[model samples]
Target: MTELVRMTGIEKRFPGVHALKQAQFDLKRGEVHALMGENGAGKSTLMKILSGIYRPDDGTVEIDGQPIELSGPKAAQAHGIGIIHQELSLMNDLTVGQNILIGKEPRRSFGRLDERELNRQAGELLGSMHMKLDPKTIVAELTIARQQMIEIAKALSNRSRILIMDEPTAALTDAEVSELFAIIGRLKSEGVGIIYISHKMDELKRIADRVTVMRDGEYVVTVEAADTPVSTIISMMVGRALKEETVTIPDLDTAETALSVRGLNRGRVIRDVSFEVRHGEILGFAGLMGAGRTEVARAIFGADPKDSGEVFVHGKPVSIGTPKDAVRAGIGYLSEDRKHFGLALGMDVRANIAMASLGQFTDMAGRLDEKAMQATANDYIERLAIRTPDDRQEVQLLSGGNQQKVVIAKWLLRDCDILIFDEPTRGIDVGAKGEIYRLLAALAADGKAIIVISSELPEILRVSHRIAVMCEGRLTGILPGGAGTTQEEIMHLATLRDAMTEEHA
Candidate 1:
């Protein structure tokens, strides 16, 4: 194999933060290299430098054995580099073909837009990738999985030889992941060097050829993916051995019900859902994609309208028509899409933490008590172990794990007794996940009722006292969480459908 990319002694520094230090990496043509790291470990920063989004303060970069100074994204692209960010960057209103060939559209005479030529090229690219998508379809009309395919198509349309994919499978289903892996196989055969960044350990075995671990802005080691254990790679990334433990089911037999929902329905998305979380207990919701677990949470939180249901908090029926009403009734919801729904990314940590409960900090003069708000924010920041320069730092500047902690702090500051967390640790690293688990346990021990919705069976088992499984908008069954229950049983329940529905199908 020929050397495709090499970087040595890479260094980058942001205001009050050293993002990368003496980092080193190498990639060979026709291979998939996995970059493993915790949140804030400088993985994104290093890649940003490679993609020309950031200039390295110190480093040497060689592409195809030729040293080059990348001035911008165009420079990197000219050098056969392309990056698909973790966040989707497509224009929602644009058609698929228009987005794929946005800047490089084939033009007609007089430099006019050639719509037919553009669609033809994009359709060819999509066809090459075996993506069954209409080039004329609006991007917003597609599912996240399909839109992800468009991102890949757009990258490949640049004729990039070195491709960088960040968390590509985060929103994909099992079948969609299989399709993506097949595409990666095709790209490898064509001699494209792929830099794959993902937190899902299971994926490395399927797609990665070499695994490079980075910790605290420095390269730890690069090992052959086939020869290295998943545990070894995780240990290198987090600096410790992570032990898998099952949740210890607490005795909630006599505990009072903190949140209760009965006969919840939402037009085929949620059907006759019923559950309860007791004080001092954690109840986990388990389901596959589109299984209505999130819909149930949103309905219970009053973020979505429920056609027929009853919600009771502490044995008192509450009318929750909106999120504000739910909050007033002692319920807090942490949405899965935290960036869009949970936090104000542009605001400082102090403001976001205090946003939900500003009335508590208001003075007699109808002005916010800045001192009180700062004191409370700092206290929660310290308590939650959020790694930021200070509480005054913008939440957008913080890493994914820290941003999640900020959301948790906001809910904690609100002092909501019945809390619902949807995909609490979705994109966070292993080390941060441990911290979140401990925090949730502590909250439960402190008698705060918690409902955790997760797609990972292991996560549901690791955190819940009891697991509720949903299938096709219906509550299939509930099982005990711990060693007594296995992933197989949960899968059976998760795929279980009503007899009538199955018969109709």
Candidate 2:
């Protein structure tokens, strides 16, 4: 293999934060090198420096045996380095081809925009990648997986020799991930070096040639993916060995039912969904991407109106037409897209934590009780192991896991008896994942009926007392959740829709 890229003695610092310290990284042509680390471990920062988004105070970068200095992203692109950022950077209103060829659009004889040539170039790029997408289609009209493919295509269209992919499959389903892996293999064969950054151990094992682990803004070690164990890599990332956690089988059969949804019908997405979560029990909703788990949760939480359903709390039917009614009925919902639906990002931690249940922290004169809110926020910050500098810090400044903890704090402060967590650990690191699992277990132990909707089968198995499998918006089966529950069994239940309907018919 050819030596393609290298960074040695990299150092970067921000206001009150040393983001990277002497971080070392290197990549060979045709190799997929994965960067592993916990949240805030400088993985993204190192990549940013490589992509010319940030200039390291002290560092040396070399490409193809030649030392180089990049002024900005365009300069980096000129040097054959391209990065697909974790967040989608596509212009929603623009056409797919227009966005892809935005700056490099071919011009006509009189300098008029040559739309045909531009679309042709973009179309050729997508076709080379074996992606069948309409160049004239609006970027916003595409699915997340397709948009991600566009991002990758845009990066490669720059004629890059090295590509940096950050959590590329974070929002993709299993089949989409497989397609991406195949694309990655093709890129590798084309001699394009890739720097893959992800927290998923399974993905690392499957797609990575070598794994580079970082800890606390410093380089830890690099090992062949086949030679390194997941446990060893995780230990290196967190600077501690992670114990294998098991879901405790709680005695929920005799426990009182806290929340029950009967005949939940929501426009073919959630059809005849019925389930009961017992007091002090953790019920896991497992399924594929569009399996209706989140729909059921939204319907129960009144975030989405159900076509027809009966919701009961404590064995009594209730009317919940809005989020306010759901919260008042002792139900709290934490959405999967926490930034948009579950939090006030611009607000302080204390304010966001108290946002859902501010009525309790209000005086007789309708003024918020600042002291009480702060105290409650501080308490939960400690309880949930939220890594925040202080309660006064903006929620946006916190990591994904900490922000999720703030959302959980809000519902707990409201004293909600039933809590529904949708994709609770999405985009969180492994160490923080353990913390969240522990918090959920503790919440259930405290008698809060918990419903966890997750796409990750391992998470569902680790956290739930009973797993409810959904297929095409219908409840297919309910299985015991534990180490004994295999992923194959869960997948079988996830696709048992036609058979289930025929059996019922």
Candidate 3:
């Protein structure tokens, strides 16, 4: 293999942070190199330099043995480098076609945009990628997975040779991941090198050819993917060997039911979904994207209107017509989109933590008791082990795991006994994910019924006492967690739709 992209002695620094310290990376032609690191470890910084999003303070970037300067993203694209960010960057107000061909739109003879040609080109590009989507469809109407696909399509449309993918599988389903891996294979065969950044060890083993570990803004080691153990890679990234945890199977036979949903129906997403979660039990919801797992959580949390359903909490039927009603009924929902739906990112951590339980901290005259609120925030910050400079620090400045902990703190302060964590560890690193799992285990053992909805099968098996599989909009099957359960079985149930009595299932 030939080295296609190389950065040596790379160093970058921000105002108060040394983002990269002599970080080095090399991508060989047709090879998928995985970058492993904890948050703030300079992986993104290095890639941003490579993608022309940031200029290196000092270093050398070489392309095919020739030194080059990346002035901006367009220059990087012109130089055969493209990056698909972890966050979706498409415009929701535009059509799919417009979003895809934003800066590269086709023009008519009269110097106007060619709408038909734009849609036709976008449709052709999607078809080439084996995506089934209408170019005329509104971007906002598409699901997150579809939007991620559009992001990928936009990157590929640039004919980039050196592609950098940042957590591309974070929102994709197993089937979609397979499709993406296939696309990577095809691209690699065409001599395209990929810099794959992800927290999923299994994905690294499956698709990557080499693994590079970074710790605290410096490159630690790079090794062959197959020769390196996942544990070893994790150790290199964290500078310590982290112990792998196993969930303790608690006996729930004598426990009382904490939450029960019967005949849950909402439009076409959720139908006839019935399940029960007992006190001190962690029920895992496992399913493919758009399988209605999140939808069921939303309906039960009263974030969305359910056409017909009966919800029981602590053996008492509850009418949860809104989030306020749900919160009053001891239910707390930690939405997956924490920044927008869960926390006010602009507010301080203490303020956000107190948002959910403000009624308890307010005086009779509608005055906020600052001392009481601050005490509560401090208590939870200590209890949940949230890493923050201070409670006064803004939530937006905290890491993903810390931000999530603040949301958990909000619910705990409000005395919510039934907790729903939807995609709780979506974007966090492995170490942070371990901490969260421990927190949930403690919460469940303390007699709080936990409903964990996760896209990762391993995550579903990790913390749940029993896994409930959702396909399309219904509960297809339930399996006990631990040794007996396998990914194959969960995947089978995930695709087991009522209409799929045939080959699809």
Best by lDDT: 1
Candidate 1 ranges beyond 4 A from true positions? 106-137, 141-143, 499-505
Candidate 2 vs candidate 3, TM-score winner: 3
Off by over 4 Å in 2: 92-147, 499-505
Ranking by TM-score: 1, 3, 2
Better of 1 and 2 by TM-score: 1
Each model's Cα RMSD: 3.0, 3.0, 3.3
For all candidates, the clash counts are 0, 0, 0
- 158 Cα displacement, candidate 3 (Å): 1.5
For 1-505, candidate 3 gives per-residue lDDT tens digits of: 9999889999997644677899999999999999989876888889999999999999999999899999999889888999998768999989999988889999999889999999999999999888999999999898888999999998998889999999898889777899999999999999999999998878988899999999878999999999988988998888888988989998899999999998999989998888899999999999888899999999999999999989999989999999999999999999887877899988998899999878888889999998888888889999988877678888865667778889888888887999999999987889889989999999999999999999988888988898988888988888888665899998888888863222211
TM-score of each: 0.93, 0.90, 0.91
Alpha-carbon deviation at 315 in model 3, angstroms: 2.2
**Per-residue C-alpha lDDT of model 2 across residues 272-329, encoded as one tens digit per residue:** 8888899999999988877888889989988889999899999999999999999989
Per-candidate Cα lDDT values, in order, are: 0.90, 0.88, 0.89
Model 1 over residues 306-350: C-alpha lDDT tens digits? 999999999999999999999999899998789989999889999
Residue pairs with colliding backbones in model 1 are none
